[model samples]
Target: MSLIEARQADPKRLIAGATGEWEIIIGMEVHAQISSRSKLFSGAATDFGAEPNDNVSLIDAAMPGMLPAINAECVRQAVRTGLGLRAKINLTSVFDRKNYFYPDLPQGYQISQFRQPVVGEGKILVSVGPDNKGRFEEVEIGIERLHLEQDAGKSLHDQHPTMSFVDLNRAGVALMEIVSRPDLRSSEEAKAYLTKLRMIVRYLGTCDGNMDEGSMRADVNVSVRRVGEPFGTRCEIKNVNSIRFVGQAIDYEARRHIAILEDGGTIAQETRLFDAAKGETRSMRSKEEAHDYRYFPDPDLLPLKFDQEFVDKLAADLPELPDEKKKRFIEALGLSAYDASILVSEKAVADYFEALVAAQPDVEKDGKAAANWVINDLLGALNRSALPIEKSPIKPEQLSEIIRLIKTGVISGKIAKDVFEIIWQEGGDPQKIVAQRGLEQVTDNAAIEKAVENIMRANPDKVEQAKTKPGLAGWFVGQVMKATGDKVNPQTVNIVIKQKLNLED
Candidate 1:
């Protein structure tokens, strides 16, 4: 069944309690680090894994009389990402000071966007559930706004016995806080929405979208209410990195809220932390309102302004996005929705598939075969070795050659697998491996006929049984294949055996 069909069959993920069913409402604020070399308002390096304070500049450290200067590249990246999302590009936006106190924050106030943001009112279409693999029932999640802000540093509490160390390497780095409206109804939809957003930022060359390395993170807001009632008090789950953890946190939080509301208890408006180890959310502190931040325009920096032509140029330079590429793969390459979706899930995988198709000009003939090899064989080997697609040992040209050998009947599917392994380990031409290893398929009609004859002669009783029970022909085929060392063409063997046994008609 399709994902939409499955969802329709069982609509609500209701919480069973004494009163009745409860509905969950969800929204997300995703913080994506811009893919730039330097920090937002400083010249410090933005490289990950740097030693503590090694990359911090005077501006990053907020030294005396150090003024913040905006990074033009960061601004361009933010604009490019906005255009990719089909968001409204405000020609003018303002940066404000968000007052907060933390040890890792060198500046007492964080420079961020409040009243005005660069990107406004966008939407992302996401598909949820395993059954919706290729065919997406798109749910349009509304994007409230995308604003620019500076990232704070890290605090290390486990390094010392009593004293904690602060690392300012990430301080003053540019972050795009993409806020979404409370359109997500389930954890599944929230996960899909995050996946879609990550793809867009990565494709735009704005964010790396590496959740493990903290390049991107999500603050999930979850609440529960009785059916047809008002929204409940929401709790914010902060900095859930992994997509699986995001879904889990939401599910746990929604149920927690429902339990409180049903037991004559009021849910608290607070910020919580997702404990991945325990699979539960613990309260960090009470959630603060906008007024609590004391937000005001920063006097050090001027308002950001640009012209329409600047936005147009950035839009023009965007590569074909995931949606566009997926449609092209389906329409032009004749691939199923599932196959196309898998291919386009990652840019590297999609590029490799395209290169393989380009290597062999007969894409119309070999496209589906190439896709199968990539998704099944190539990806399986890579996963087994725990290697990314970019580090794959088998080149696209080599894979294309392997597919061609199978299509041209030079090698059977089984033999091609052996060739693929050899190319992966030893690194040589697929055809050369086949030729040198004597892996060529045996298509000699007479030799196959003799093998079939010998098999039938040896297993006369089985052949007699086959004459009565036509399904027993498979035994003869398997015996012939084993006798020929599994190198014989299976189709030819089947045809010759059927002719000998008079099973053809």
Candidate 2:
């Protein structure tokens, strides 16, 4: 077997079917639009939301006299993305004509790369499972190749009853098709792999990786077989817009295959479209073999050639990617693997965490506290508010201020959360809020002692029970804090409550 097909599926990831257990094998071809102002072979505007055909140039329209001139920025971006994938960069690669008929394709054939792509094999290490407990099962997904190509326009079939309208705003727009080896087995693995791949492209700044914008999408190839058997016939699910939908399509298709096999039915190799509303895959057409396209080298464009320095410069400018940053967070800052993974999942989230740590110097030693607040509190609040991290009401400085107060015993954790809600709703300096509102924890020994003594006096019956059943001291502690408006640190209240009740720690 080739290196890409060498591995066996994890027994745990096998799907439990009607009659027996089956294994699923998945491969993905992710088409990511190159982040550029112009199209790949023409100076046509690549802007979205423009009037139909307004962004297209004479070349994009394939006019008789027009010649193809590649945008250098698109090529540079493709190369930079290849380097970011940790894939080998080919010094030379050729563009070929993919012959096909489509309503939206202005050119009779799509100018694309084949045989020798710009990028070679690469691997992305994805961690699956709960993504917590500082625990994960790492799976290495192989990237077969990344080829540069042009995107077709959108066909607006709903605009007319029988006639169709073509919007060439996206025509000739640059794209990088990153194909993965058949290394994924389960829907969860496919989801994680897609997420990590998107994360990489986003980190590289080559593609925005926005599926909703039609800037990025995936074609999933799914096949199923019994354990210890060869690969079975695969069906391709086309243009799954969302990562969630990708998983849904795979789950539905794999089960369909398993059920068909169990019932003694043969599988057909076909291209299918995922009906997300119905949660199933429907046949689109017969799956095309490579020879069906009749691929031939494009006569208009020359081969893409770049030197080592070109690739070297782009690699040198790359920012710390997710894996490296995650490693640093775990080793240098002492963050748990799960926490580190979460913090570095997005570049903005990682930036927020680093800034928070920079703001609170004490958290540098142990970023678990900062990670918890970011992942649990700030992220949770952002998600609830339907806001992105960039639109956060609580800045890094503002949150670090709250952390400072809690660490310094200026406010109890409970009071801090109250302050957090107040700050979350309306902006304010956390320290100033605590000072102005007298919200600081009542850490005074005399104050706690007085509250404890009063609770003992009022509940004389419970005070006796406290001495015998020492757990009743907890009841006294709560009542003392309640009597004092819950402004005191529970830890200090517990200590003094124990002293008043004469109970051991």
Which regions in candidate 2 have their CA more than 4 angstroms from the true location? 1-4, 131-134, 362-366
Give the number of colliding residue pairs in candidate 2.
0
Question: Relative to the true structure, how large is the alpha-carbon lDDT of every model?
Answer: 0.88, 0.88
On TM-score, the leading prediction is 2
Model 1 score (lDDT): 0.88
Q: Poorest 10 consecutive residues of model 2 by lDDT?
A: 1-10
- Taking every candidate in turn, the Cα RMSD to the unseen true structure, in Å, is 3.5, 1.8
Q: Which regions in candidate 1 have their CA more than 4 angstroms from the true location?
A: 1-12, 132-136, 363-365
| Least accurate 10 contiguous residues by lDDT in model 1 | 1-10
Write out the backbone clash pairs for model 1.
none
